[model samples]
Target: MAPHTHIKSVHTLSPIDPWWKRNLVTYHPTPKKSRHIKVPWWSRKCAAALQAKRHAFAAWRKNPTPPLRQRFHYLEAQCKRVILDEKRLAWASFCASLSFSISVSQAWSFFRKMVHPQPPLTFQ
Candidate 1:
């Protein structure tokens, strides 16, 4: 056989390439229902403590030093304590408000909300 004179082109595009380039992918937004349920025990103080604990954790993670780790632990304990205290107080107040006059449906509604709160959906 004679010497082959074959050549290959690297920059060749297929016929369907133009169709893919011309049509853009689009996404439609999904509608969601908003839930405005309120927690009886959550407060601004708890939020602040939790934020501080998160910051301390970030600092500890960045440096991994003993001091920072200790600080993070302390903040974590403090945050837990504050949350527990707030919950206890809320529970106490709720117990104090209990009476024979309260309707069964209203009490059950409160219990339902407290026991199984529906979290908002995130578009992750």
Candidate 2:
């Protein structure tokens, strides 16, 4: 019958379904991480070569013909060569960018990164 008693009854906390639990249950979402990690030396050319090699390998796997097998091997080799070239070019450019113009600290940072690359981020 009292006003304070009425307010307390209206705002009473229940144990069956807490407000925080309701919110957490309603907020199911996808992971906010990237699917593909970018490699320093990865390029469109390398992607194209790898795609071609995958296709060749699939084709060879379906029908085990000698020609298809050879084609797959050739594409695999081409992909490796392209990837190596890209890595070499990337390293050369990075080294070229570091010169007498850069400060000692920057040069040392560059050298450290080149010597010990950071580990890629992983999502479980």
Candidate 3:
């Protein structure tokens, strides 16, 4: 038979929170998103080819091989072509959107902006 000892219980009084404070809206700040515009990948095939070229590059970096270099070069050319096509398409779309009804001043301004896009000024 084991001897049992009586345990003493202590009471704790924590400050009661007000009902209003309990329901108060708390703002949780999240990471700010980048303001830069995200352009779409040239094309699905182009994107895939680019990824493959990257893999080949990593392999070449690890061990310099003539075959890997050749493949990477070929894929690089394909990627460049795709990128050029995408750019042309986007420009075409933008130009098409400015219907005939657009004012001459507005069209001129749009054309000017397209020709020389003022880079966003950044203060370091």
Local lDDT at 76 for model 2: 91
Best by lDDT: 1
lDDT of each: 0.69, 0.68, 0.57
> Cα deviation of 21 in candidate 1 (Å)?
29
Indicate which candidate wins on TM-score: 1
Ranking by lDDT: 1, 2, 3
**Residues 8-62, model 3: lDDT tens digits:** 2112212353332333324323458766333432356556666776787898888
Quote the positional error of residue 77 for candidate 3 in Å: 0.9
Give the TM-scores of the predictions, in the order they appear.
0.60, 0.59, 0.51
lDDT of 2: 0.68
Clashes of 2: 0
Residues 1-124, model 1: lDDT tens digits: 3422441321243454554323322232335656656667777887788888989999999899999999999999998898778778877887899999999998887666555443212211
Steric clash pairs (candidate 3) = none
Error of 3 at 99 (Å): 2.4
Q: So what's the TM-score on candidate 2? A: 0.59
Question: Arrange candidates by TM-score, highest first: which order?
Answer: 1, 2, 3
Please give the TM-score that candidate 3 achieves against the real structure: 0.51
